[model samples]
Target: MVRELLLAHGNGGEETWTIIKDLFLKYLDDPILSKLEDAAVVPLEGHIAVTTDAFTVSPIFFRGGDIGKLAVCGTVNDLAAMGARPMYMTVSFILEEGMSLEDLETVVRSMGDTARSLGVRVVAGDTKVVPKGTADGVFIVSTGIGRVVYPGLSSHNVRDGDIIIVTGTIGDHGACILAAREGLDFETHLESDCAPLWDMVEALLKEGVEIHAMRDPTRGGLSAVLHEWARASGVSFVVDEQSVPVREEVRGLCEFLGLEPYHLACEGRMVLAVAEESAERVLEILRQHPLGTNAAVIGRAQKGKPQVLLRTAYGTHRFLEPPMGELLPRIC
Candidate 1:
């Protein structure tokens, strides 16, 4: 029986199979994964959306979710942003020596639970054990494949007169991690907004919403997404500063820490560009879902020089620049 992960488990020998067959397979069981083949064969139809992501969050476990859950949600959301339906996923893990088997099992179990709930399968995986201190406790890389149901979605598809809507409040995930890492105390508790978003995206498609562009505000947050859309579509954005939704606790933390909430990452939020006429209807649909109850229309796009302009509560306009430098390293 495996008690702890060892280098021999990654040496391409009997121990490796024992751990994979006994532990990983036991948790992530599926016809594709059960084949024990070098590569998984999956069926696909229509255009496919493929995305890969690596997770290196310092504190493996955090409020609302852990590294395992983050790895799955991050990849799933990437495909969701493309208006795709998630189907299959491949996971790889790097484990440090002396890592507890119980902890590894917990992580694997979390991945399995998330995959099942999202109606996706973990069809293939690999594991490696590195010498102690040579690697962090763990790192996960996931690759996802999705079937594109709604086609023609592009960042360049955004046009003048399109309204911008965010699925929920921004900066929740980033602030949650920061507070957890620093042991900061506040009257209100902050939790990461880590979650799978394909269902919410599917709802929009079902309603026949005309989606011009969509992106999950991840590493660079709201500022990054707006700047990217502005540059890609060659249009300017007039954002209402007061209209952008920010949780009271998140706003407080950002103010106390001298951080801009718009620059902080969100794991479960989507920034959308749709026709102005459909903006309110889209927001109405989003609010029906638990994940998007706080959705808001924050801005409108117009034909002008490619840049984002923020109209502040004080009635002043200023350019909203893309975030530069590493705001929070290993924040994904």
Candidate 2:
């Protein structure tokens, strides 16, 4: 078998079969996927949530994760934010010619490990190759299908007095990626906070916490999630700047770069709008979990114009703007 990917590997001939059997199937082998059919067949009932995403991070590997892990977590987290239990996935790859098979295997292995940990099955997949320099080393596109475990969680569901909760410190993933790409020399290393959130979110639902809205701040980060909810719910938001969690490393890097930490992305954290009555209990539950140890009530939803008001710790106020354009392109 060729150690470097070639265009013929995607020709749907013997070379393709060799990779499918020896590489992709070797790691992601499941009954459905092993069938090697054009499409996947699985039984899905009840309210199902489906999401698809394409990842093209500049570097395929980074601190705490690689493109493969990002692909799985990104898709799984989308379903989780909707209060769903992720179940099945379809992954496709766009491989650039001359890419190393070893690197490709590393990505596939990461994807398999992540999916297996979450009880998700990769039921279908496809691969295509392009000439070198025409594309990144590898770009992954994934689709996830999940069962809606809890119904009616939406940005529009936030009501007045709903307490906003963050699952963890924000912007770790974004900062980590930025530092890695910039080759910044720092005493403390930054790592991506990229992980699946279904377990934590499921814990909240199981504990009877009433959640109105949940969003994983991705491209535009926590700031984006809050501003979007404010508009969708037709209610203003008041966030205490001090209460919102930000790691020192992340804040330092943002300040050094003249960027706002809140505008950076977080791959694993969740922002929740919960009922005021359940605020403290939610905090108690979140605090007990490993991922939610830093969870805090950043603000509350109120009846006002749709906007996010930032209440500085020094008794000052300002509007937190949503992200514009690409702050850091491909900082996934």
Candidate 3:
């Protein structure tokens, strides 16, 4: 076995076959993928949701998760937000030559474990290697396919009186990535909230929660989801600033960095708009899940021009601006 990766590993020769058989297949064995064909065929019914995402986080490894986990969860969450049950995925890797084989194995193993726990199949993949300086340590791209279980979940579905609910504390992912990259030391450590959320959505569906629109706040945090929804639906969201949940550490880090936590990213948490009548019951169902212990009703959609209004604790409301330009690099 090689201690480090070499360009030859991607040459589709002996080294390439050895790496595939020994590492990827060893961890991510799937009946459909075992056929080793150019494309995978699987059975599916009803509406299907498919999404693709690429993970190039600055630090390959972080406090809570690595790139592998991010790639899988990010893709799966995209499908889940569409009210889908994730079924299959394909992974492709771009590796820099001289990368550690052990790190590669660890990443591959994590991808397998996360997919297995989520009942998603890793159906197909490709590997390519670049010169040491030509690419980051590693980058993984995953495409997910899921069966739509709860239909009509869309950004355009948010109603004027719809209630906005956040699944948990926000900004952990962006803060965690920022700190990890900057080497910031804090008394209380922060970790990325990277996680797969199919179970949480499934739970809400099982309980008959009326979900009009759903989004997993990622690259641009809750603000992005709300702004996009507002733009799509031509509605405004009145968010109570005090009601937004943020970890003490995350808040502190954002304060020190002069950053808006609302504009930061969250990987594990979700933002949804539901019927006013079902708001409390939806919160109850969400709170029942381990991933939603910090769930809260942050705001409500209102009839207005497309925008987001932030009601500060001081009792003044201001238009929350969308994050402009590149806020951070390689965060998710």
RMSD, every candidate, angstroms:
1.4, 1.1, 1.0
Global fold similarity of model 1 (TM-score): 0.96
User: At residue 140, what lDDT does model 3 achieve?
Assistant: 92
Q: Model 1 Cα displacement at 85 (Å)?
A: 0.2
lDDT of 3 by residue, 195-307 (tens): 99999989998888788999999998999999999999999999999999999999999999999999998989999999999999989988999999999999999999999
Q: What's each prediction's TM-score?
A: 0.96, 0.98, 0.98
User: Residue 87 in candidate 2 has what lDDT?
Assistant: 99
User: What C-alpha lDDT does candidate 3 achieve relative to the native structure?
Assistant: 0.93
Task: Write out the backbone clash pairs for model 3.
Answer: none
Residue-wise C-alpha lDDT for candidate 1, range 1-332, written one tens digit per residue: 65777888888789888888878888788989999889999878789999999998877787888888899999999999999999999999999988888888888888888998988999999999999999988899999999999998889989999999999999999998888767784445888999999999899888887889999999989999988888898999999999999999999999988899899999999999999888888999999999999999999999999888899999999888789886888787
* Model 1: lDDT of residue 269: 93
Show model 1 residue runs off by greater than 4 Å.
1-3, 185-188
For each candidate, the alpha-carbon lDDT, in order, equals 0.90, 0.92, 0.93
Q: TM-score rank, highest first?
A: 3, 2, 1
lDDT comparison, 1 vs 3, better candidate: 3
